[model samples]
Target chain A: MRPPLIQLQGLTRTYGRGDAAVSALRGIDLTLFSGDFLAVMGASGSGKSTLMNILGCLDTPSGGHYGFESIAVETLNQTQRALLRRHRLGFVFQGFNLLARTSARENVELPLLYRGLPAARRRQAALAALDLVGLSDRAGHTPAELSGGQQQRVAIARAIVTDPAVLLADEPTGNLDTARSHAIMELLTRLNRERGLTIIMVTHEEEMAAYAGRTLHLRDGLIDRDSAEPDATSCC
Target chain B: MLLNALLLALREIRRNLLRSLLTVLGIVIGVAAVITLVTLGNGATLMVKQQISALGSNLVVMRPGQRLGPGHDEAGAPAFRREDADAIAAEIRGVASVAPVVSSTVTLVAGAANWSSSVTGTTNAYFAAGNWTLAQGRLFSDDEEQAGKAVCVIGQTVRAKLFAGEAPLGNTLRVRAFGCEVIGVLAAKGQGAMGMDQDDTVLMPLATAQRRLTNSRAVGTVMISLKDGVSASTAIADITALMRERRRLTTAQENNFSLMDTRQIAETLSGTIGTMTTLLGAVAAVSLLVGGIGIMNIMLVSVTERTREIGIRLAIGATGREVLTQFLTEAVALSACGGLAGIGLALLACLGLAAALNMPFLFNPGINGLAFGVSAGIGVIFGYMPARRAAALDPIEALRRE
Candidate 1:
């Protein structure tokens, strides 16, 4: 069998210290292979966001072994972590955090700019990414001028522009209505199938989870259920 | 990366054009005040030096009484006679020439044009002692001066006022009761150091003035010119000693006369004006620091306002350094624009003031360049704190800010 693309064994995350210390993740053991689309779901404060942040390298686990490919993530310094994020990870936020007053194409080019790509190639790559998201004609439109769904499309385009190894999305469609949410989910589904892009998403909605190949439910800092483990029962 | 950061900064500034301009207004006024004050001060100092030098090279004027300037009241002091001028010319080693002057205000009539002006009486040595040059015609001949002939040389102002457009050479100019022939005209000397009109006077023979005008043998003042390379202090000491001996002043008595050195007066005036210029410049420089504080205030506000934008950049793989550079570049761009505008404004102000004050407009590149460099430096100094604050923001917290 091919080795797992990501491995987290006995991972734990705690905020603050001493009597005020609170555990966000409690001994999470998980494995993800390349091309797998996973969805994480839980109620508010159920540790789903914490797990996502650790996986995305935006936060360090207090105790754990987080192995991405062959690199030990928790051992990396802040600058090294940033470099890993810059070269391998992409993020999509719930609010569609595109730079205000900036053109859609320029928004898509942001990651490439951090990559230090030349201007002409950055333009070409940004346009291609915009085309993939069906925003070729709206490339010049700023975030304020674009619709909510279009802005989310631009956000997705920006995330995938650098060809990152994993796209970690935090409630990618939390602000959208049912129709637009499904439309965005469809776009994510197409990117997963056509480009074979690995995606790990956090959401509280079952409908959004349906688009993923597998689902993991969290309850009070521990995994209550994993869809891959079909025999497991919900703890709550 | 620097170019990209600069482009982003410019875009941000362009989006908030009016606010950026208002933010830099303090810098604009500060730099303008500094350059204008220094430039005008330099012009005034130059004018004073030029006017004093125009009085004569190595020239000294000895007047009765120890006080100088207005309300001197020299009536109690004894006046020097014509013999005193001869005595100084013969006794002093550095003395090149001496002229005894007996001046009186008189009304002159030339072709129905009557004007009141001071008349100076002396020998041909007066021309050498006071640095006078004839614009037209000739100086008084020895025979004309010795015989007390009615001949005079009018100054440019007197020529312009009394003669108008007509030439006054050989024309009879009536002095009170008698008439003197206009033998020559003195070149225009413009204004004196004390703002008096230097060209509004007439020069006549000592015998002529004594006989026709003052009706006295006493000379009111003695003008002395020293030879080249003579130390003025030494000459002044020698002349003072000789005059004291001739006036019969004892060792216990204070000499009833004062000496005025034109060169020393020039140095004192220039020194005072230079100090004043430095003081004004220092005050203006403080305003520059205040302008820098203004920049810091606006930059802090800008960082707080753009916290969300900073968060977006960080989340998308931007390093803290990049964010810091972006905000710092914005601040420097704002101040540099203010600096350029200030330099332009100062040039216009200096030109207008120079013309209005009748002073030379000396363009000093060193000060302009220094001002611009200092303004740009203020940007770096005032920009660092805000940039660091922006860089230190947490991605999670910043993204949550509205």
Candidate 2:
């Protein structure tokens, strides 16, 4: 019913040149709509990280057509891509990359700070984002003072503080215990259902992928399977 | 964005305060050295010029030697007599006054106080020629000087040592075989051109000194002062010609005398001081440059250590330019703080040293401001490369670093 928010065609990423070249992604063709919750799974060398990096605009594909909301992403320059990320994309790293020794509130305010928002509004929005992640009470606590799960929550708050169109997460619960991993997944699920936020996650855990509306498995840099059947033309 | 960068820089500095302090120590020392040396050097130069001028800019001294420097062979030269002084006073057109002088070191006893001091013999005209002003009492009278009366004018230091707060005027001072009455006390002149105390001697008439101290009629020096609007070179030529003719020196014979211009001495001494100041300033500036290199080295290390943080910022949409600005701001901030600290330290050091060395405390705003500006400029010059490195880092690769 809705147009696709992201479209990728013939995406290929290769590291190095000539004899030492290693192809991280052979080719990938996919279309994702707004509010879609997708999980990507693969083995260690299956290029899941490379694909996520390309999707996050942190790396450019060797050859590809990447369209974000009908705009060609591959044609954008580095500064343009950074601007795209600043205004429309959000990211959560596997390491929960919160600045060490910084409070959760300031961490959340970072995006707004980059956006050049006024201090008063940055503070209000950061507080609101922290509250959404259920971390309002620990907003003043630094990463070292917080638990792993709480740190992940703060990272999520930082990611969503700018209200970006898509949230790309790389193994968001990789370092958490079982109960904490489940708790983070439940929080993601709640954010998806209540706020209708679009999320693309990379994980190897089956249970974590089970929470997403769709799952794609990769083997040897190619899609092994797609859990949901497409209603449009399919390549595989 | 700049505000954010500044805050980040300040926070980073505060995080490792000790390391930050150590990193800027080179800059602090460099700036402090420059300011202190220049300030003291300037003070010394001013003191020298003042002391030289105090000897009277228009005055010249005639000594019986080929030159005024070391190893001068004045042994064969004839000493000047008081008649030569009288001849110059009468024959020289521009001569305002002339006083024949002879000096000898003698120990004098006044009450319980005893001091070893140089006793100078000259006419009352010596007061005007040497720019000596009376702080109390009166100068030698015509009758006193002509009769070679035993009346002396004590210098301030001599009064302090020999009189000890007691009224020196009309008091008798023992000088060799004769007892001279103190008729006046000269005003204090702190230090002379050669760092010697000027106010540590006694003055008497030419005849009195020759009779009581030297036991000879030889005048060791002839001080001549020129009238206002008179050319020193012209007057010197006239005086040299007259002296040479009186001594019956032919054109083939070298004049067996030297002339000392107070203004010339001032110029030579000031030039020497200026050269020394420049040399020391250059050395200090090298330290400043080395300090800049130190900043660059530390900044490079900082960029390496904060690679992950840079990656995080980049991933969250920070542009390369923003990252560059952040690192540059940190460097500039660190160096600027060092500059301020150096200025404060130099102020204290200059004050203490000026007092200890008995030099004036001369505060030079231009040098202080220039030092600060240069130190900050060093930040920009040395910070650029490391900042560019930080900005050029690939987000993916940087994040991959452990």
Candidate 3:
């Protein structure tokens, strides 16, 4: 009976103008409830990243309705959208975009810094997040000093430092080897199961998607299938 | 937010230390040049004024030439006589004293030492009109001047050259054709405003020089002193009228004498120094502007180089304004540090130059502070465009730059 965490109705996005225009997303209607773990899978140019961008408030829909909780997100100004990201949304990038020379602890504290948290509280929260990702011992190490998997863990810690409402990850484990990728998926599954945190991830690997409770596949700017149904591949 | 941005800026600067220093070198040179030039110029002006004041306050010189500069035909001009000086001393209301001076350069021999020095002949009142003081021994008495005695006062340079370590007073020194007794030693006055050595002279009574050395009654120049609080213009008018009548000049005839006020000379010299300082300061300020442009150029390149980092910050929740403030803060910090280094460099240069030139070190707080403030302002002015460009970048597009 509670409202969904995110709702997208007839979402559409276009790249350019007139004859040169390329449609990246077309009429994406979806609802993500609280505590849901959803995986989005698609070939290249299938608008999975575009949907993630809109959901994270990093991009606006050209024509559609997007609601976050009870507020209409498409009508929010730039400042409001930035505030939404600051307070509610966390992001994990494919490249583990940690500031180059900064230590792991300082990198994790960035979100709280933007939120203007007190230094003491920011340090405490960042340390706790690092502890959660098992990177507390590597707090003083920079990204160059850490392994690929360790760096991704630090990025995850940074993403969750503010305890955001939802974690939006774009290929969070795409750059890892098979063993490291499995370990990251296991961590995500544990975080979802133990903390009841909502997560939406974009990945091309079916093995990574298998960790999610539900999966959606996109083709040519439209959702081709939803794995929640029994015969989803037949429909596609 | 400011503290966060400042911390980040400092980190960035530290990471690119060599590049940052190179970027601010222009500002350093510009600020240093301006401060050094202005400080030395002011010191020179002050020295000129002080030398002029040393010639005596409210003093005027009457020379018998129509032209003022060097190479004028003084041979054809009528020279001033002792009667003209006596007439001004007796007739003018604000006149304090008058002394007729006749100077000639001659070689003086004292035992083994011989030196060329200027010998000036005037009465005891010349010491009062010209503010000359004796370092030792007494000045010549009125009886000595009336009787045309061969007694003189030697300046410090003459004493150093001829007497060396011996006592100069009551010593006999040969002047041109005859020997004169040194009755007193004048105090050291260093150098004159025109770079002449002031202490290389000998002073004697006017009657002695007129009767023995030159055998002429015409005086070279007449020095006038005015009473306290009396204007020089009033004294000049009075003396000009008296001189015309004394010389029998009709109404239509042009006056053959020229009057020079010490105050006017000081003003003119100081004005010239001030104009030169301004011109040099302007040139230095242009270098400052060039330095500012260098900062802008570096900042633009930095923004482009860090586009992906900017995108990362934006994606992590930093507002465009926050990113803009960070970049601007970096620029301002760079220029301000450059300004501070420039001030240090300028102070060192000024100290060395002042010592070398034998001028006092004058610190003008106004110009130093203004230079510092302008450098910081230059940072803001030049940094704005690049910061705006960085802030205006689209997050997705920036992230895609790799």
Candidate 4:
């Protein structure tokens, strides 16, 4: 009876036009409910990244209906979409796209700054966000001064600072070593379990995919497989 | 929001410090050079004007050729004499004082130093008519004028050359083999409004100068002073009528002599200098425009370099307006800083040059303020394009950029 946090029906995305037209997604249907962890795995050019871009509201679907919390994305303007992304969606990326010169706390405070919060409250919220990602001690350090894993954690803090409804990660561990990757995954797992946050992630690694509660495989822009992760790994 | 944007802008600029400085270099030079040039131009103008003001704001000059057109029997008419001075004073209601001067160049000798100098023969009215002050001794008296006393008053330049830093007062300086005691020394008057030396003359009784120095009784010019609140037109008309009647001019004939103000010469000089300053300022102003273009060029490059950064800020919840304001603020800050630097440099240049030349130094506050404000404006105008581009970029495309 409860509505899904994200709904997609009959999604199609085509790039270019006419002779050069290529369908990146074809007739896709998906629903992501609250407290769900979904990992999409695909080879290169499998349209997984394109789907992620669409799902994250970074790109518009060529033909589809997408509702986030029952609100249609198609109705939102660019600014409104950005506002929606700011207030509701969090992002984690393999590259850890942190602002080059800013300290970690300032970086986390950026979202609140956009919210037009006063300086003091921004500081408190940013500190809380940093504490959530266990980057409290390094809050004053710039991205360049931090390690790759630490920088990613800072990026996560920035994302989670607004208390967004959904967390989207694209190849979140692609750039990290196996140990660092596992550590990041464990952190994400705790956030999901303790906060009941919805997460949609993309990766090609089976081990990383195995950490998710369920998985979907994309091949040539179409869904190929959808299954629950093995019981042994799901609880962990 | 503005403060947040400012913090980010400052941080971004800090991240690429060298490049940002290099980019703003043209603006810096342009602003500084403009302020310096404008300040110097205004100072030079003021220097001339100050000389004018020192001559006394109320003083009026009467030159024969400058007023009436030359030609006719009166063209070579003898200069106005003492009788004319008496008539102007007695008949013209506004006439406060009047003096006749007979001037001629003569060779003078004092010790081993000999220099050609101007010798002026003037009445006691010369002091009040020209608004002169003594630096050392006394001006010629009425008895001295009536008796054609051989005493002379020396100017600072004349004393400098004749006496060589020693006080020339009470000393005799020879003119044409006749020695006249320097009873007084006029204060250092520097250059007049017309850029002519006002301190190279020796003054004596008009009768003494004509009878002894030049061997002629013909006068050279008339100097007139007016009472406060009297219109120059009223004094001019009265003098013209009295002089014409004195000269016995026919009713149809215009007066031959020029009765003018000291300010006319200043007006003429100032007009000339103003034109020259405008021309020079135009050349300097072109550099400001070039500097603006330089800002635009650098800002465009910045927008490109920070495309992804702009996207990040947008994604972080900054409105397009906020991004726009940030870029604009950065531009303005660059310009404002450049303007302040320019003013400092201009002041320094002015001080150094003014000291070196020993010229009258004047730094006009108005010009300095205008130069500073314009420099800042140049930043805003030129930096607008790049800032708009940065603010207008699509968040998705920006974030998607590699």
- i-RMS for every candidate (Å) is 1.1, 0.8, 0.9, 1.7
Which one wins on DockQ?
A: 3
> In candidate 3, what are the lDDT values of residues A1-236, reduced to their tens digit?
87899998999999999999999999888888989999999999999999999998989999899999888999998778888888898899898988888999999999898998889999999999999999899999999999999999999999888888899989989999999999988888888889988999999999999999989998888988887765855655
- Model 2 stretches with alpha carbons more than 4 Å out: A1-3, A228-236, B61-95, B106-115, B135-138, B141-151, B159-184, B207-221, B226-264, B281-290
For residues B1-402, write the lDDT of model 4, one tens digit per residue.
Answer: 667666766766677778777666665666667666665666677777788778766666665543432232346655666777777888889778888888889999988899888999988788887778999899888788888888999888898888987878788889886889889999888887656899999999999988897777777778888888888777887787878888888998866777767566566676777788777777777877787777688778878988887888876666677778888888777667667776777778878877776555676788778877887788789878888899889876888787
Estimate, for each residue in B188-243, the C-alpha lDDT of model 3 and write its tens digit.
98899988999999999998988877789989999998888989998888888988
lDDT of each residue in B260-371, candidate 2, tens digit only: 6788777778788888987998899888899889999999999999899899989999999998999999999888888889899999999999999999889999999999
Candidate 2 global TM-score: 0.87
TM-score between candidate 3 chain A and the true chain A: 0.96
Lowest summed lDDT window (length 10), candidate 1 chain B:
B66-75
Candidate 1 local lDDT, A124-156, one digit each (tens):
999999999999999999999998999999999
Task: Kindly report the docking quality category of candidate 4.
Answer: acceptable
Ranking of all predicted structures according to TM-score, beginning with the best and ending with the worst: 3, 2, 4, 1
lDDT of 1 by residue, B324-360 (tens): 8888898898888888888999999999999998898
Q: Report the C-alpha lDDT of model 4 over A1-236, residue by residue, as the tens digit.
A: 88889888988899999999999999778888899999999998999998998888877889989888978997777777777887888888777888887899988888888888899999999999899989899999999999988998998888888898988898999999999899888888888999988889999999998888889898999887778524423546
TM-score of chain B taken alone, candidate 3: 0.89
Clashing residue pairs, backbone N/CA/C < 3 A, model 1:
none
Quote model 3's TM-score: 0.91
Candidate 4 residue B208 Cα shift, in angstroms, is 4.4
